[model samples]
Target chain A: MTQASPEQLAAWIQRMAAQDERAFAEFYDATSASVFGLLVRILKDRTQAEEVAQEVYLQLWRKAGSFDPERGSPWSWVVVMARSRAIDATRSDRSYGSALSDLEARPTAQPLGNPTPRPDRAADLSEQRELVQGAMESLTEPQRETIQAAFFEGWSHREIAKRTGVPLGTVKGRVRGALATLENVLRPQLGEQSMGGD
Target chain B: MEADRFQELCEEFLLSGLEGEELRAFREELDRRGAEGGRILDRTMEAMGLLALSAPPVDPPPALRERLMAEVGAGTERRGESAEGSGAGSTPTGPSLVEDAPAEPASAGAARRDPSGPGHERPDIGHSRLDRPSPADAPYPWVRSILLAAAIVAAVVLGAWNVNLQSDLSERTAALEEAQQELEAVDTLRQELATLREDLGTIVSPTGSVISLTGTETRPDARARVFVDPQTGRALILAFDLPILTAESLYQLWAIRDGEPFSVGTFTATEEGPARLELDSLDPVAGADLLAVTIEPAPGQPAPTGEMVLISGQ
Candidate 1:
């Protein structure tokens, strides 16, 4: 994973807000891999990921001025934007139902595998990635699967219930429980997040 | 939507799972929350974003970058052209990202190519004329007159309809703006109410300790109170009459344990009202003997090196 620090990305975003093309390019170079990685995982198609990636960057460009540091780190903002757009793309597509069914048929796995390997980057996880992966691994199997379905597969609590024959309440419980566990474990590692502006 | 439902769906909303009617209702409620809703969203986004980091890294194709830059350049050129030609292409400053996306992604490119993409589609008048019988080919001389009369009437009716549509659109636009403003006000009130509720809980908790903080020698009038839960170390500070902070500076609260200081959080104060800072869990602070607030150049300071403005009594 590219090691662009939150501060560096935030600064780049600030410059991008000023319509600095160089800053935009540098920001893209530093973070595009992570953004693309998330998009591909959710969308499950490289072409579609690539297309959405363009839209994501375009959005980043146009909305750079609105990037509030008080809200989140630049990387998180980018990830959230990428994930939301990818999920929206999937939801809008007519083929999503069949894709969801196909995904449901497969055995659940941690860090779901991608068959098409891009030679441009190494497969090693970054330190942050390792930390997140460790926290994820710490979850109970059910909790992990429920969260993975929701986060990676874009399955809602109701969708997960319908697809896996799990009770709706149970699915919601697992998600909430899993999130609490992750937040507890990751809080110290993630550092203090300021919730309000000065 | 009920508050309970809002709380329940918050996680899903942060994960971007809610769709259709549910999504719309949640957004409506969120909009009504004003600033408070925004904070909830921000916090949730940060958490969800971290979880997304679990995704394995994959580098995008190099071509995507080239294509993106090209598109950006084209957009820039278009913006510049529009700016030069007319004032109609004003830059958008709002933070509405999702709504701004092209309604149909594939058709977006096609629409971009069409010069009249932003306007209503033409009625294909040329085609209609071609399909019509020419005046010279008319069986009856009065047929041409009737056709001409019909055309005039249609044009007049169409123009009237267009005027009505424009007037209705303007009214709707103004109404939407007013509703949005009202929603923002409601959101602000919601945020304050939430803070008040949390403060009340902390205050009424039987297990919490109230620590009084008084101004240091530098300024004798600053006063603040900290309600710390001894068991969980969750603390809330309500500072009153503290010096107003400059734009470049903030007040950082620190809990002294042994000889070292652990940062609780950073906040700003107003002379007019109380400023509140809440710490989720500060285990070290629960047992610590002292809590201090200091002015810092920025937030997230490792240790307080700036002037101490307020300190808890021994």
Candidate 2:
């Protein structure tokens, strides 16, 4: 739950790249917690999560120089790094099918056309399922299911189409449309991300 | 006009499955449009975000701090001055919080007696005149002798250190000079490769062959791959999963020419870390030839003596 200010952490990382240990420690302290949280969520298993989190930090250490402030916030970059590693884990775990299915089954209760609930205005995240359920309910049932399937199930457009018996193009369109809907619904509550760079 | 055309990229963009010119084109267009471009790209990213919706936030092990610090500390100590103790050491306050840590290995050395305890924070300038020994206070003659021996050892180490540092500085300066030269050579090489990739990217040829090069017995995890453009006498060596070589070792690429191997070039992979290497303009040999890589001593020897790390069948 400890959040790092991306810009400050990024400055520390620059020094870390030059092999400044104290700065490295500072960077690790600030972001590793959030990154670990992200990996644990994606990987599900504690042991695997810890392994992947270690890999993530090692990667962060190695790739610190390549961290582009302009591309995305450091927190988002770290989260994305954790997710990519977790996705790799899922593929290797071989039980990915069941995991993907369960993720797809996650309910988003938000109604159609409602902008995403802002991260804060959306209220407490302790009940993420309930919050997601509410926002999901806001969607048209078809869009809701499609978004969930594509994202949570890790289904490609073709896979989603095949399962739902919709055209691939149509399935793809719905996924993007649903996400645009989520951002709009959630943006107000999340604050406009400040987006912070050129 | 390109906006609508670019907008058609919705599906591909969301999946991040774009490659070659198309992906580059999208990036260029994104740069041109700025915030609007970000918004356009947002829809794709949002869908991707949903892929992991319930992916619970996993907290990293608390001990990761110690590991990261230790690893980072080693590299930092070798490369730059540490910031922890210096900031407080310069002050009359004597030592900083980090100095108070009796656990560090550096503090155990006789070259430095860590006056880091909170009790030692006040300036000890007066201790310069303190008597060298007292029987009651000294207590352990063995311990005192050990401390004296340690001081002698420390002096010897300090003398060696000054010499070692001078040599290290020279070596670093030489390495820097060599790195600059190598950078120019590699940049030229990459430019050559980039041009070939640009042309090769254009062809949707069915005849082009893709080959996976597995590492030989020497380094099992070391792998290299290729997409050969037969018509152009070119091959893009997309090296993957290969460990980055140390400065003493460099990766050498070989092209099989007329039943024997020939050295095409010697180089190191991207310092930015591995992705893919596009080794363009390679001499095209005929079917079932051996294209190989060997680890060679740095500045690359005339022929590799180090093991053939990886190989592929043509």
Candidate 3:
């Protein structure tokens, strides 16, 4: 609930950059667990997750300035960086073969049902998405199905094309059109913050 | 850029990860932006971020926090004098953090409330997929907190379900620990028990005398030493180094009170099995021959029909 302002967060990151022990401690406190949680999801190994989480933070400390609030939210950027590190690490392990096969075998096509979702992480389910269900409800059957297949399943255009018997171009085009419309239609009803994310 | 264009690229970008110059240019432009650029960037970022949201972050070992803080502090201190004013500036913001090798002189009370460690969120830095669990035995504090919670709940439930089992476990553990602490105590206690058993075997009467027995030709490998306290009219039988009977058969003992056999006792022995038997202190009526042992079928008959393996002195 005690959210940091963009400027305040930026300043904290800056102080961290300066070798201020407290600031570094503060930054680690703020971001390490979130980063660790993200890495564990990807890597699924405690040892590896810990290693990647550390590297992500060190990278963040080293390149804090590289983070611009204008270009992307720090949360999303951090998620991406952590994922990149995790994916790279995962690829090198012998288990990568099995992991990819596992992903292919079970193409998850929806937000996982968290029957007892931690209150802190409910915010992570896409802030704008509280109304996304409503927006998703508004979409035509075809558009909704196609969008879920691509977005949630991590399906490629070719895969979607094969599954739906639609051309690759159409599936790709429909996905793009659907996301734009969902945001536009939902923005009017959801308000900026709801759409903007907390 | 227009929302439509951004949305279009975002879809393509999410479907296939950004690569080479495409990703490079994107990172560069976003890093140089103001509020407008930030909004555009955030929208694109959010759109792409949705494609893969199930990623679980790793939990590192508990010790990682100390190591991470040290590294972060070092990096900042190295650049503080040079990067001042800007976020990564030269000056330390809240007094000079490079003042000492950490808050060493702090008191115990302070350490307890110390958000810097322990109750801290369990710092795990760089304990990524690259690290092996074999080398890193300590899991992150958050993970440990979860497991500890589970363990406590288990202890509570299991303790309620089986009080005897819990007590038994504790007793076994305590016994093992006690034995470890004082070997002589255990030894002395064992010796005392044996002596008591020997003394307790005697039964008193006013008549009869002592007798001894030796092994038969069939079992030279078997040996036994017996003593009959005639005044007490009780007998103690100690058998050692006895060979086990075949599966269907067992060893038995007898009292030849008269020349005629009196079915006394039935028993069994195993490889290296040792046994002590106490025959009832019969009121020594007038005459008794001696004691005898035989191997027999599991359900022993009232009289001796099996082969006599040993006959002590009569």
Candidate 4:
């Protein structure tokens, strides 16, 4: 879990765009766990998650040329793509209503249960988790819940309001407030330098 | 919109919650501000992406990497073959004049001595193979003329053959790509069919309880069934003869436990008249008394927010 500098990762991605197989292998090794973990949380079915994860990496290979460093870091690009795929899978499932109900049953404070971490990367991942967790602590319980539903559960403001019995305006307000607070707290600790490509 | 409103939309855009007119407006505003606004949006997206990393990382199965690499290798090989085939047609291949000519030094001296002599024609011959050679000193002039004519015809034929081969190779490459896409589609369908077969086997097992639900007064033609394995809490819904729903609405199933309704799943009927729905994770059948279906708004409601269309006889 020793992170590559953003510039180094960007260089690898550029090489991948040129169909460099070794560079792609390196990129996959660096980011697959993060992508897979996010998919498992979003999809909730390990088999489906694995399938989607495979598709995500395959897509990264084909669409590497479309990656723009000016837009975001390579890690951000891959994570966003993984999230989009997982969300699409959930939406297309006929049993998605059941998944939503199961999600509602969980406490909003912990939308997803902690996944079992790989022993080799546990220390680095734990440190990263704590940084986020500490930033999240600054929000009110309601704000945290709203942000969790929006981020992890992929709920729209209207859906969050309907599920939590909060007013739509209230849910929107909490989301806005929570995002501002998170950016303020996280920006200093996880500054722009580590991310690279402005 | 005001600056504050645009900023709020940026957050919503990052979360993918913005849509329709608001989404359009946000894009326009970003365009209005150009690079500065885009940079801000990119920064927000990067931060949000990092935030997602807070989730504990789970190791994917080692086999996935091997499978992906194998697929990528295959793709790369196909690309390499296409490139090589196309390269053969475009590659420059004639013998260089400087390498072939025996009187290079003399020609160089002659060109330097006379500003415009037979040297000018020699340069033209170098540029275009079709250009006639200078009638300087050769043993049999007519013999040389015939040889040059034959060489020109050979060059024309060779160039035409290369162009034709390039065209054929391009068409073959396109066909291969299309066939590859078709094979991928077939593979996807096979996987879906396998999953359905597995579900069917479980539903027909002796441990499974079959509950038939008939349509209510609202839609008497509709019918459905729930197959539940009490021990495993696995359930599947098979709906038939149901009316197609409008885009704004869908059919939802609810599991009733102690008079409280919990959503089991949602589905819409196809034109062919059947829909298969799998419950995410079923509650123990022993704890539930009935299963019911209702027509609710699209995305479904937390509770039954519409008319109950079908219910189990229980």
Top lDDT model: 1
- Compute each candidate's TM-score over C-alphas: 0.51, 0.40, 0.36, 0.49
Mind sharing the TM-score for model 3?
A: 0.36
Q: What TM-score should be assigned to candidate 4?
A: 0.49
Candidate 3: tens digits of C-alpha lDDT, residues B28-146: 44344334333443454454443333233233566778877776665555545435644532233222233333332334234334366533333234447657655257657578778
Instruction: Give TM-scores of chain A for all candidates.
Output: 0.79, 0.62, 0.53, 0.76
Candidate 1: the clashing residue pairs are: B33-B187, B34-B187
lDDT of 2 by residue, A12-76 (tens): 87876665667767777665555665566555577787787767776677667765544444554
Candidate 3 whole-model C-alpha lDDT, 0 to 1: 0.52
Give the top-scoring candidate (TM-score). Answer: 1
Q: Per-residue lDDT tens digits of candidate 2, residues B169-247? A: 9999898877866875564455446444454562444667777778888678877767777665445565666666653
Clashes of each: 2, 36, 42, 0
* Candidate 2: residue B195 lDDT (0-100): 48
Listed for each candidate, the true contacts retained, as a fraction, are 0.41, 0.22, 0.28, 0.37
Q: Candidate 1: how many backbone clashes?
A: 2
Please give the TM-score for the first chain of candidate 2. Answer: 0.62
Off by over 4 Å in 1: A93-127, A194-198, B1-4, B19-21, B28-34, B77-314
In order, candidate lDDTs are 0.67, 0.53, 0.52, 0.65
lDDT of 3 at A133: 57
Task: Look at candidate 1 and tell me the lDDT of residue B95.
Answer: 21
Please give the DockQ score of every candidate, comma-separated: 0.20, 0.11, 0.10, 0.16
